[model samples]
Target chain A: MTDVSHRDAGLLRVDTDECKGCGLCIEACPPKVIRMDESLNPYGYRTARYAGAGCTGCGICFLVCPEPGAITVLRAARPRQSTAPGQQARP
Target chain B: MSSEPEVTWEIASSKPASFYSTYERKDELQHATHYCPGCGHGIIHKMLAQAIDELSIQDRTVLISPVGCSVFAYYYFDVGNVQAAHGRAPAVATAVKRSRPGSIVISYQGDGDLSAIGSAEILHAANRGEPITVIFVNNAIYSMTGGQMAPTTLLGQTSTTSPRGRSAAHEGYPLHVSELLATLEAPVYIERVGLGDNKQVAQAARAVRRALENQVRGLGFSLVEILSPCPTIWKMSPVESQRWVRDVMEKTFPLGVLRDHTQAAQSEAVPIPPPPLSMIPGIVGVADAGLPAEMTGDADVPALDLQVRVAGFGGQGVLLLGEVLAEAGLDAGLEVSWLPSYGPEMRSGTSNCHVRLSREPIDSPLVTHPDVLVAMNEPSLRKFCSTVHPGGWILYNGEASPEDCDCRGVHVLARPFTQIANNLGDARAANMVMLGALLEIAGNLPQSSVDSALGRLVRNPKWLALDETALVCGRRLMREARAEVSHAG
Candidate 1:
């Protein structure tokens, strides 16, 4: 239950330790945002690693990855609210 | 002075889109008022609209519509869309995609627009792995032009060009465009389905979504080759065409994910980051098999035209072996087309591949005349030994001595193909072993380049050495022959 982070510049991101490497994250990333490392984890599979910075961050990969609590993303930072004068002037 | 030039015009519905309107999903893109009844174009248009909406690419989307019913997709998507020339969606999409990498580009084409005139455009586009999605619709004949034989037409499907069943002796079988496209790795996803039945509809949706998703990921090429029904031409009503596409087209084209990026992601166990579209030109060599060698044809001495066939039971790896030769030719810059023929009976019956190599674009897939043919069993020999051209070479695999094929105009070598395969450990390595012999007698391939090419296929050094050894042995045994007709002279 970490924040739904959008890593790779809001494309994709995941926590490496929780990854069981079942490839659910890989299968879910449509643009192939997840990749496997060469070293196999305890499950003997090279776990899915965050692939690239091009991810559009549609949240499909985050939703479909079967491993629970494996992937996390830092929310895209939002700017603070504008002042009333700026808002009223439609700036 | 308000100068006015007299002009009068009237535009009607052209042909009411009753069929399209009926099939329209109310929840999606309501009141989309363009397209005609019994038009394959509209289905693709709707699918694209739904995909854009679901994927939310609408805000950053660009649709390249060619001169077909789909040109009106712009009317529905409410996003920027351009109508390109006839069969030039790839070129147009190429420009749009390169200029605006953030926008999702969709190229929609019909049979004539894609397979016939613009074949080269799409091939080179996919070959380059442009970050674009192509929706190729095959409806057998060209409905827009009053029905002519398109490159994707089935063997028996009658079109204007072939009033009689498409004679393989002439027109040949329908082009398995998806199968051909699968050979290239640049495309991150490729799938084929028929829109005739409910099952195929669901499968098509999955494929479309998969392709669209790949785009969202910024993966390279994604295409969904759909076999839609053109009732206006096939002498069938819209419903009948749908049924025919379901029963017949699906049987021939078979519905499935030809190449699933997601599956590749699974097996790969980790995601490989795809480079940006800006670097595509510099990254062409980054494909699975790196850029091929330079093949300037033998100009001083022309090479003999050859048709090569590799045949065996389904699991025999015969096709892979043939691909090595084709890639070798590709390296040599020789024209090549690899074709396979099969029904429900693949393993139990005869399974063969057709490879035609020339100095020019291949006009036909059927190898009417083969200069060299490989038969891995008695059944293949029985079927194709007669088809070999007079003075052609035949390679067969037999446990003991050579079996008499009793055909004319060709020389047959019945070697212990299985025994050699056993020595290699991996029986599938037999195909590569067979390739060695094929290159030897045919002289169509450079053995060194082929060895280099095959190296990319097998990773295990032990297995790799065995294939090389088998190739060397077969190369040594090849019966030498004098050049007949060379392309140069």
Candidate 2:
């Protein structure tokens, strides 16, 4: 079990209202952390949900998802100390 | 514990900016698209929108949505949208791209619409190397109008139209569109991708972007054919349908880049802009003669409305006589139209023409009932005499009018005009003599207009002189005939 305070390298958000519950994202997630919810959405179909841990954030789920807004992937920012001297900051 | 650095998350992937915030295609589903739950069009649309957003060309992009399920593509895409007829997306895209050369035009089509109905259009567009992008979605079967067989359907696939599972002898083999198009010389890029799994989806996204990028760079034609899955129509779960594409569909259509001439291809030639309205007359070699003085608000000029039907054998200048009449009407500042009907044979075949000269704008060129019938032969006279209007004049070329023709209330001037032309110089001038008599009866067009029209049409000076003499003789014949009738009365 992962500690609640520990931040993983990646995070994922699944909008229940926009999800059609096709399970493509769940099947495509490399970490196998996404699952179909037991409850139905407003349109009466099961929706995908993040399992709260072990996300690598490769963004394959976002690529395979049919709905544009259903899946959003986020990657953890690198530590400030690891920044190279001549490297430009991301905008 | 205090030494650990705090970590924050930033968005890696989200919805693209090219899609509308809310789809207003229907009242109920404002937030959702019209596609089925696991439909491939949604995924493809997202990839396309992402490309448009990344390229920063959303404002100048024109998406030509074709018939089939994706006909409502305009509802989702925020770019300039045009819904084309089934299978005509490529042709429509060509026109749009040529007219608005700066705009990025994309033709989105389906298997039934592209490979089946619009095969010729796509072939020609690609062959010409039209600087446009084509996104072809092939799902093997037609899903929009129920699951019917498509041109790209796999050989053993069972569709509503192919209930017994398509056989080679019955339906023939599946069409390889990417390969077929690659054989053409003009296309700069052609690739086939699939949406069966994550890897394929990622590759498809890259191909879609590259196809659009080629258009942005002004490279020649580029096409990306996507083998998409239809879950509902295939009667399989979404996952199983996708698996079918990878396992079964891939065997029939191997995925790869079929053609890549983008590196060697130069930017296509800029299309010539259409001429301005003022230059059209000069370009077409028509003198910009505005309406004549007599045509504008003149109360004394009779309201000229003449419908003339001229018919004869093919070599008897049937069409030329009609052309001269229409040209003279133009010179005289009247609205004119001439329609010719003839057989395939160049000579000795039947030919006819309808000529209309009206003061008002002519509605149609067809003259079902003419004010006068000029028949240069016996068969033509018998055929067209009944169609002349009541009290109209019939100028027949024979010695006398046919006894069986029901020329009840119409006036008949039956003269051997061919023999008269033979005495003058050539029998071919008989049409000119008939035209002269007809002009004398109408009395609307001036002799100067006819002379100018004849000068513009007749190239040989010898034939022109003989035709002029024939015309004077014809006028004399008509005058003498009228005098004799008055004396007999």
Candidate 3:
């Protein structure tokens, strides 16, 4: 239960433009969720990568990365509020 | 405003101002971090940003991130930042602040990056009073490379390199860098703080802020040397590591200010007012821009008049003798240099020294070949016996009597250094005894100069001062044997 409070576990994003071929993220992820691609980015790094639902978004990938702006973690969207303030529709 | 610490955390009374990401939320705020959970780096990063926001110097500040665990410092700080070469932040910061005098530069460095390869760079920059702020995170061991023994590792502290805890008599004691830099007149602020508790962490934050404030005031060379924790490398929980730094490490490295000019109104080291940025030299060539030696102004180090190498085991005082010889030569108005080969291979491995003594200028201090070889072990004799200059001496440890036939044409002295030290009762004295014998045989020091040099060295009354021991032992070794008479046909 305490794990849910971890500030770093969130939705993830990627900054492809700054990504280098260095796959430190793929290596660091505990879930084995990310992989590299043959296609290269503008920086000539085989900079493309992909991730899956296995990404619990620990952000260790974001942390261990050498390249800045390469990894992003986006939080899950909040549910929209009802028309009435402080109210929710019945289940 | 200087030393008083600010609050660490505050829950939103309502909500943080719009467009300003909340410090705790995991949404857009997540973009601010690229760090592992439970990593102590997170705490440091947050503190730096908080201090920046509080001070409102974000626009003018320039952060320097060197290659290390903290290399991604540019990511979190919403300011201009440049990446520096590995172990070159101090040098890079030195250049940046000089180039853009209006811009405040801050160097964020780690133990290995700052104190290992970049030691001299840091010393020289601080010595020159460079107007830059340096945040040195000393985690006792290197974190970026897993864990290696950093120069500041405490004696008996374990690391990857020192699996058997560092030995004080071998790896030597932890370097007190803040204390060392405080000795220099260049730095205006110096402090060492740790983050073991709420109080200590708050103090660490304040130390960093004090350095930043000094930069805003145009003070030269402000440094906050933080004793940070690398829980992953330290093999402890974050809490335990914090306790370790606060408790165990703090025993050796006490908290509080090492030096702070802001505390007092007047100090001997007032910040030198900035010169017009236009007048300052830039990255490119600018000759005669060399401050007259009058500024760095000291008598130039003369050229090496003699070159010697001392090779021995880890326990032997081989390196100390080499440094002492270099200091003595320097005292005698001769240019001198001493280089000891001590890398990952220092213990139970090949150990040697390259000392160059010159009458003119010494360009390169490394002795690829030796004029004299002071060998205290079989390896030293076998390796360096061939390199000695013709008609020069090889001072081999007399206890190990290797046949002279193996080293043909090389003058050899099987001097009993250990036996001499036995007379002295400290086994370590053999190195001094060997050095003393060399002085008698080498004749590099003129009779008049040798006594003056020896007298200057020993008058300190400090027994076992390496240089003094070298001098006395050198004299005694000469006395033990008659000076080899020069033979002429």
Model 2 ranges off by over 4 Å: A1-6, A80-91, B1-6, B276-489
Off by over 4 Å in 3: A1-91, B1-32, B263-489
Q: What is the lDDT of residue B334 in candidate 1?
A: 71
Give the TM-scores of the predictions, in the order they appear. 0.41, 0.62, 0.45
TM of chain B vs. native, candidate 3: 0.51
Model 1 segments beyond 4 Å from truth?
Answer: A1-91, B1-34, B263-489
Number of the top TM-score candidate? 2
**Per-residue lDDT over B1-489 for candidate 1, one digit per residue giving the tens place of the 0 to 100 score:** 224332221221121221122223223323333333234455455456556667877777777876544555555556677888888999999888876767778888877888888888988898888878898888777775567788887888787888887878898778877888889877778888767654555567677777887877777788889888766567775556667887898777877777766545322122344567767866875545556575555673226467888888877877777777776676666788888754321113446788887776677978866888788877777777788889887888875323465656676666777777777676666776677778777675666667776787667788788888878767765633223223324
Better of 2 and 3 by lDDT: 2
lDDT of 2 at B29: 55
Ranking by DockQ: 2, 3, 1
Q: List the residue pairs that clash in candidate 2.
A: none
CAPRI classification of candidate 3: incorrect
DockQ of the two-chain complex in candidate 2: 0.37
Minimum summed lDDT over a 10-residue window in model 1 chain B is located at B10-19
DockQ for model 3 equals 0.05
Shares of reference contacts reproduced by the candidates, in order, are 0.00, 0.68, 0.00
Report backbone clashes per prediction.
15, 0, 15
**TM-score winner, 2 or 3:** 2
Q: Give the lowest summed-lDDT range of ten residues in model 2 chain B.
A: B341-350
Better of 1 and 2 by DockQ: 2
